[model samples]
Target: MTLPVSARMGGLAMAFRAMAYWLVRYRRTWRGTIVVSVANPILFLLAIGAGLGTLVEGSVEGASYLAFFAPGLLAAAALQNAFVEAGFVVNSALRRERIYSTAAATPLEPGHIFAGHLIFIALRLFLSAAAFVVAMALFGLIENIVVALAVTLAATLTGLAFATPLAAWAVTVADFPQLNTVFRFVVMPMYLFSGTFFSVEQLPGPLRAVAYALPLWHGVDLARTLALGTATLGMSLLHIGYLTALCAAGAMIARITYRRCLHE
Candidate 1:
């Protein structure tokens, strides 16, 4: 069942072609995205970080509330963006627009199509994360360039960890309402409770355990640690390992789901 090395390389090259297709299509649709990606972080920083931060500054340990809050927001924002790009969009391609179907009609295998789309999503995550980091800098939330880049990388990894599995599930969904439910029940709850707005330690024992189990908490913790310069090698590796495992597992699942959907 193993393909030759040349064949594998060719499949990857085809996947890149599929990514290029999305990149070109994005040229027309990117304006609205850019506005949201760039402005949401800044507005959140102003309203919540600066405004609510003042009220809770004394309660937060070690750093100002804004400083404590900004990195977590960056991680949460990346999660949101990745979900938006992967959820309904993946569903639309499989159902309404039939983009994946169209690609399947060509020589491309399902894995190539999936990889291409995933790559494009990763690119989007990186751009959005980088923009948010810059906004953090403008507000003096991030001081070091290396730290800013590390935070950005963490955000992007956090995003892919969610995006891959979400896309896998999106392919199996029957309608838009199902995706809506996921956003409402799943993504929204994580955003509100995943150590983004407050510390997980504030939760009761069971809730704290649940928060630790969620990917967003790991992401928020990693980004905050890097931003605050409080990262220990062991803890950083743990966060990275958790997110990386999710990303790898999700990609595997997506490949299987995509192959089924495309063949059907």
Candidate 2:
């Protein structure tokens, strides 16, 4: 049941290297990504959170629409940036740019390849979440430090849950536009309907059930409940279980797909 220390360190090292690759390989792009991630969340707050709050009633997630929705927006933004890094970036690197092929030509193993990309995703998540948190602090939206940490972690995990399989799925495509469709179709819709703006109870019965089924639904649930401190122990455990299961499932699917794509 216990893994060797060296094995664990090796995995960590692989992930570090993957994250480093982004900095070294595409320094300007990575910097721009950081800037964009930070800016996008702020814009969302001003445009949607502030603007739309005017039309709505009392509040959501315990605070005004801005406070209640801010962390969820942060979590969702982090989720988005993480997937964009792993799914689109990794897919292009592996397929179009043949980076994975080049790496495979060396002594590096397949698990390292997977770990490297995942590490890159994690780095993206951390940077994006941190930036969003800073924005939150500057704008005065946070209520609890523990809630802040929990929402950030939720954002990172939520991103991983979606990104791994999405990266694999991107391998089958011949053109980059397919990723655009995925964003517009899969990521965009899940984000819009995942109880981000209004409560899920606000949605009708069937739509509410569908939203509950989405991965981001549980993710936003964790973020929203934690931000507002509304979740009971049982509900918290359920949310964690849902996210963990989705992340595991995504990793499994990514592994199988990578084998098929990279095996010679």
TM-score attained by model 2: 0.89
Model 2: pairs clashing at backbone N, Cα or C within 3 Å: none
| Per-residue C-alpha lDDT of model 2 across residues 100-132, encoded as one tens digit per residue | 777767656666677777777776787677677
Error of 1 at 88 (Å): 1.0
Candidate 1 wrong stretches, greater than 4 Å: none
Candidate 1 per-residue lDDT over residues 74-193, each given as its tens digit: 999988898888997999999999999999999889999999999999999999999889888988878889998899999999999999998998998877898888889989999999
lDDT of each: 0.91, 0.75
Let me know the TM-score candidate 1 reaches against the reference structure: 0.96
**CA shift at 136, candidate 1, in angstroms?**
0.5
- What lDDT score is found at residue 107 in candidate 1? 88
